[model samples]
Target: MPIPACPVVHFELPYRDAARVSTFYQTVFGWQLQPMGPEMGNYILATTSTCDSSAPDALRGSINGGLFPLVPESPLQQPSVVLGVPDVREAMARVSAAGGQVLGEPMAIPGVGDYVVFVDPEGNRLSMLQPLMG
Candidate 1:
């Protein structure tokens, strides 16, 4: 098999109070948030500008997921997802223009690059990251 040009690299969580969740992350770890896709119920995504303390300039990220209200049918926080992006800001703008929400602007992480979070039309949480130069 051949390597795909692009791949579905990560999966993330789904939350109901997207705004609240976004805020939670922003406060906890200083991440930015962006909303995506009203057709999917104000789905939001998130990203981080900071890198791991050990590796200040490293691009530290997991997968990306979504945030939507827990359906009475499905009750759970789901799993946290990590995502990858070449450029966090560009990805955010693209997502927002495509009907996604720009929940928060990019934030710096001291020695790390910049990051932002966002969601899709389906309410899946996602993150974007950019590494800072030495």
Candidate 2:
């Protein structure tokens, strides 16, 4: 059997000014911005399309994302896409085997899933997420 396909389920971008970026996207694209608390790194969740709470990925072709405060020292400060994987650990191994570098250990996102960043062979920054099952 062929390997399971991982889909781009989310996108993330860093922002210098939270209010400015939130207003821009909300006013221009009509995206609903939900500001998370400090416990969750103050990440701003952006809902670009309608979704079913019972099923996170139930709405095919529709993806949501988050906006994070930009940290100049971090390597993953640029815009990037997040691929949904069934197993983040396995994906990390695959990335390394394919000559890509896993940036760090997987981090748990409360109410979300395990997530880890990686760099592809061509140096593009990306992430893998193993979402929590209900």
RMSD of each: 11.3, 3.0
lDDT of 2 by residue, 1-134 (tens): 56689999899999999999999999999999999978888799999987645576555578899999999997768999999999999899899999999998999987899999999999999999999999
Q: Which stretches of candidate 2 lie over 4 Å from their true place?
A: 51-60
lDDT of 1 by residue, 34-122 (tens): 78666545656555543444666656654343455566684334554444455677777778888877558876645656766667777
Estimate the overall C-alpha local distance difference test score of candidate 1: 0.60
Best by TM-score: 2
TM-score of 1: 0.40
lDDT of each: 0.60, 0.91
Model 2 residue 39 lDDT score: 82
Clashing pairs in 2: none
Provide TM-scores for the models. 0.40, 0.91
Worst 10 residues of 2 by lDDT: 51-60
